[model samples]
Target: MEHREPGYVADKAQLLKRLRRAEGQVRGLQRMVEDDVYCIDVLTQVSAATKALETVALQLLDDHLAHCVAEASAEGGPVAEEKLREASAAIARLVRS
Candidate 1:
């Protein structure tokens, strides 16, 4: 079954654009390594890319909580608890990262 909710649909375009830019940054990092650019500079770019990805993750988490989890909570049952647990685990993983 296809789970097609509007999770993050509103930020879809902006998210894609950010992800593409992050992709380009990763490519640039590869090139920098191949060209033997300064280690610090490359690390700086890596940090930028990492932050970009983190931002995407955060936005996704927010959307999930606002849409899926909220809906599930309103329903009030095992599914709601499952959704809350899922969100908590996701947030934990993000925090660890």
Candidate 2:
């Protein structure tokens, strides 16, 4: 896989921790399915995983705007504006999803 930027990598570490927890939740869900556990319990686990992912996405987006976009803008010219546009589009797409 490609390397993450330093700031992003820091956020990614936290996200990865959350993902691992979510992974455990998925395994629990799988066991629930296998053991004929309640349907609502499994659904609740799924919802938790989705929310965890969304939280990670929002954290990364906030960091990108605060650091990368800010740095690019400070340097002047089109790069900063382009980065902001890209980040905005990405955020929009994420929200729509």
Candidate 3:
């Protein structure tokens, strides 16, 4: 059977909003570069954009853990273990980034 990722479906609107905002920030960054903006100012904007994206990632992770992982854990056995492992791997990748 196929499993649905609840977080994405549940937070679909909010997630899309966040992603769109980040995409706008990226476009602004490109404009700044094209306009020959100061290095430090551009760097600051880049940092802000990165943080915004990271916040979205963290929020999604929290939702996944609370909804997906929690439900899977309650189910028990292989599926539960797989979900936990997937979450752990996601966390590791996030931390490394």
Candidate 4:
């Protein structure tokens, strides 16, 4: 199969920015643990980091549905079925997380 640009290509920069911020949050979390910061404070930061990642995930999922899945569906064949299944699995994983 030919390689295609990801559905998130247009928003790649924004995605990277969010990911970097999340990375920082994680690093901060590590520092907090090492410094013996209050437990509640660490948990709050953890929630924030999780929320940031969830936002990124939702954006990517929307892009996939709008671009990859939509394009495959238009073609209407095994590719479309595969995309649909892949998307469903992704959604399930996100929900479980």
Number of the top candidate by TM-score? Answer: 4
Model 1 TM-score (2 dp)? 0.94
TM-score, structure 3 vs. true = 0.92
Against the true structure, candidate 4 reaches a TM-score of: 0.98
Q: What is the TM-score of each candidate against the true structure?
A: 0.94, 0.78, 0.92, 0.98
Worst ten-residue run, lDDT, model 4? 1-10
> Order of all candidates by lDDT, from best down to worst?
4, 1, 3, 2
Please name the candidate that would achieve the greatest lDDT relative to the true structure: 4
Give the clash count for each candidate.
Answer: 0, 0, 0, 0
Model 1: lDDT to the true structure: 0.94
* lDDT per residue as tens, model 4, 53-84: 99999999999999999999999999999999
Residue 72 Cα positional deviation in candidate 2, in Å, after optimal superposition: 0.9
**In model 4, how large is the Cα lDDT of residue 20?**
100
- Cα lDDT tens digits, model 2, 19-88, are 8987887788889899998888889888987888788788888888887888778987888778889898
Query: Model 3, residue 88: displacement in angstroms?
Result: 0.5
Window of ten residues with lowest summed lDDT in model 3: 1-10
User: Model 3, which residues run further than 4 Å from truth?
Assistant: none
